[model samples]
Target: MGKAKYLSAVEQGMVVGARRTGLSVSRTATLLCFSCSTFYQELPHKLTEQDRQLLKCVLHKNHLSSVTTLTTEYQTASGSNVSTKTVRRELHEMGFHGRAATHKTKITMHCPNSLLEW
Candidate 1:
């Protein structure tokens, strides 16, 4: 069965506590609505503290930075290859939403202060 939700530390602890209390794996899994394999699975986080620091620094210096640019900078700073999608995902997780320029200027706008030509 698919995961009902991502298992946080609290959820893992609950599973462990349940197991210690003589609850069977299937019973615990049923109670939590998690698959039996979920208790045995451990997923590592993609970004490190250093990577987060670098991302914060880069974003602070340039608010308009694109995901591609962020990925490039992260790769350069951390010496690790990362995809733009990963960078975009991390940005979203950190609450940075995509920004698009919406303001448009007139095509033919004359200068307010113009000198008379002979």
Candidate 2:
């Protein structure tokens, strides 16, 4: 058989189209850079069951959960020590992060009438 052409443009177009119309995987893969076989072979890494449960627990309990807290809790509960770095990696994997700053102006102007009321 002859060498097959890479359909990167078609794949990209399909991905964009999928975003618009939500096409099936086979159709999307047919349009991609690699063949459907390659796409199926290189499926993304998904979280294991144990990790998913642990993440659910961590997220459910804490308001200000951080990597340090999660790692410590995981080690204490499961007797398996995971590094802060590892916890951070896991948090990133699960799409969690510490809160970002609120950009509110701090300065306040007070009127003499307001002061008199106080």
Candidate 3:
């Protein structure tokens, strides 16, 4: 038995070694300078079917629409009850642009004839 040898290599070197190696997973991982368990753990997890659908809908619905309008429509159609902040955060995450306009419309739009009482 002798002292273990450790070689220093950049991240790119490890990737190239992994691609060229024809060995067991553990051996490949050791040559790449990483643990086998860690190598497998680095793989990305797939999104659920529901999440995929939601993402597709979000991407196709509007490109530059107001966040408030999108949130309202999503809530009305899906009944998910997400907050305005969540909607804004999602829009930001998606890399959408444009500022949110201030809402200045009257509270009540339908008003019939009314008599003044002075």
Candidate 4:
């Protein structure tokens, strides 16, 4: 019930496997090749200068670019590699769905049908 460290699904599965095998935490940590303290501690990733520049360019100029475009541009401009998925994930975290607009038909709405005949 206490605060859980930031473990991925794979790491969680590893922990579960260790528990199922009746190995001690230290043993599990050893098997994973990471210190027990490191396993339990959360290490947050800070944004790099390139990432800050990306955010800045997007916000300052109202930039609208696809994940592929962003990644291509970023690599060209910053001389670093970036995956399209990472760009997309960052956009989603920033509340951008990376879509022009979501489609919704009138049939999906529950408005009064009589309005259609009027």
TM-score per candidate, in order? 0.49, 0.46, 0.34, 0.44
Q: Rank the candidates by TM-score, best first.
A: 1, 2, 4, 3
TM-score of 1: 0.49
Clashing pairs in 2: 11-31, 11-32
lDDT of 3 by residue, 10-99 (tens): 654665466566566688777666666655444332333464357448646775666677777767766677776766655555575566
For candidate 2, the lDDT comes to 0.65
Q: Candidates' lDDT values, in order?
A: 0.78, 0.65, 0.59, 0.67
How big is the positional error of residue 48 in model 4, measured in Å on the Cα after superposition? 1.0
lDDT of 2 by residue, 11-32 (tens): 6565657646886667776555
Top candidate, metric TM-score? 1
Model 3: number of backbone collisions: 0
What are the runs in model 1 whose C-alpha is more than 4 Å off?
1-43, 101-118
Q: How much does candidate 3 score in TM-score?
A: 0.34
Best-to-worst order by lDDT is: 1, 4, 2, 3
Q: Find the 10 residues in a row with the least total lDDT in model 3.
A: 40-49
Better of 1 and 2 by lDDT: 1
Error of 2 at 4 (Å): 17
